[model samples]
Target: MDNDIKNFFKEIRKLDDNIDIPAFEEINIKRNSPRKEYYALVGIAASFLIVFSLFFTDEKVQTETNDTDYVITLSDENTTNTESLILEESSIYSWEAPSESLINNFND
Candidate 1:
């Protein structure tokens, strides 16, 4: 085994050194990272859309025309009030507070 390994390495070392390796070209694809302001704007827009839809959505319940004496209803308008209350409660939570320097220099 030792002789075989030595023979293999000697064979490799004795190989011609005139072989040329191809140069690799660098790839330069420009990557666009999302900005903080863009994310904030998108978040604000989505929140407004959700709130608007919740506030303006119709509270009507549709009944099936089948003769089976079973009617399925989501809730008796109680869920709507509960959802609104939840949204109101969640409004108390906010993003990180502004930097102290920004707060102090608000007039500037």
Candidate 2:
């Protein structure tokens, strides 16, 4: 088995070395390297489009419903404020009334 392996390796080493693999490989590498520049250009274009959309795409987006005055409600009738109600209650209870409350409601 050892002798068979050595013979196979010696036979493989006898192959022609005049074939130039370097030039073909150099051309392939150069051709593939230029794709990096194309990729960079595409990246820049995509970034610019994203930025432009964020800033300029919607200057004034008038939604279909802009007439919603939802925060404030207006009424024509006058409503009683807390201060005025307290004042009125105080004035009513301040009068001298008969001591009918002294009689218990449980009696006749």
Residue 30's lDDT in candidate 2: 48
Model 2 residue 61 distance off true place after TM-score fit, in angstroms: 3.6
lDDT of 2 by residue, 1-108 (tens): 699999988877777455556776677664446789899899999999999887664543433234453456657447545344444454666776576666655465
Error of 1 at 15 (Å): 73
**TM-score for candidate 2:** 0.27
State in Å the error of residue 14, model 2. Answer: 1.1
Per-residue alpha-carbon lDDT of model 1 for 82-105, expressed as tens digits?
A: 444344443435745659678779
Query: Candidate 2, residue 4: CA error in Å?
Result: 23
TM-score of 1: 0.23
Estimate the TM-score of every prediction. 0.23, 0.27
What is the alpha-carbon lDDT for the whole of candidate 1?
Answer: 0.66
Off by over 4 Å in 1: 1-34, 58-108
> Local distance difference test, per candidate?
0.66, 0.68
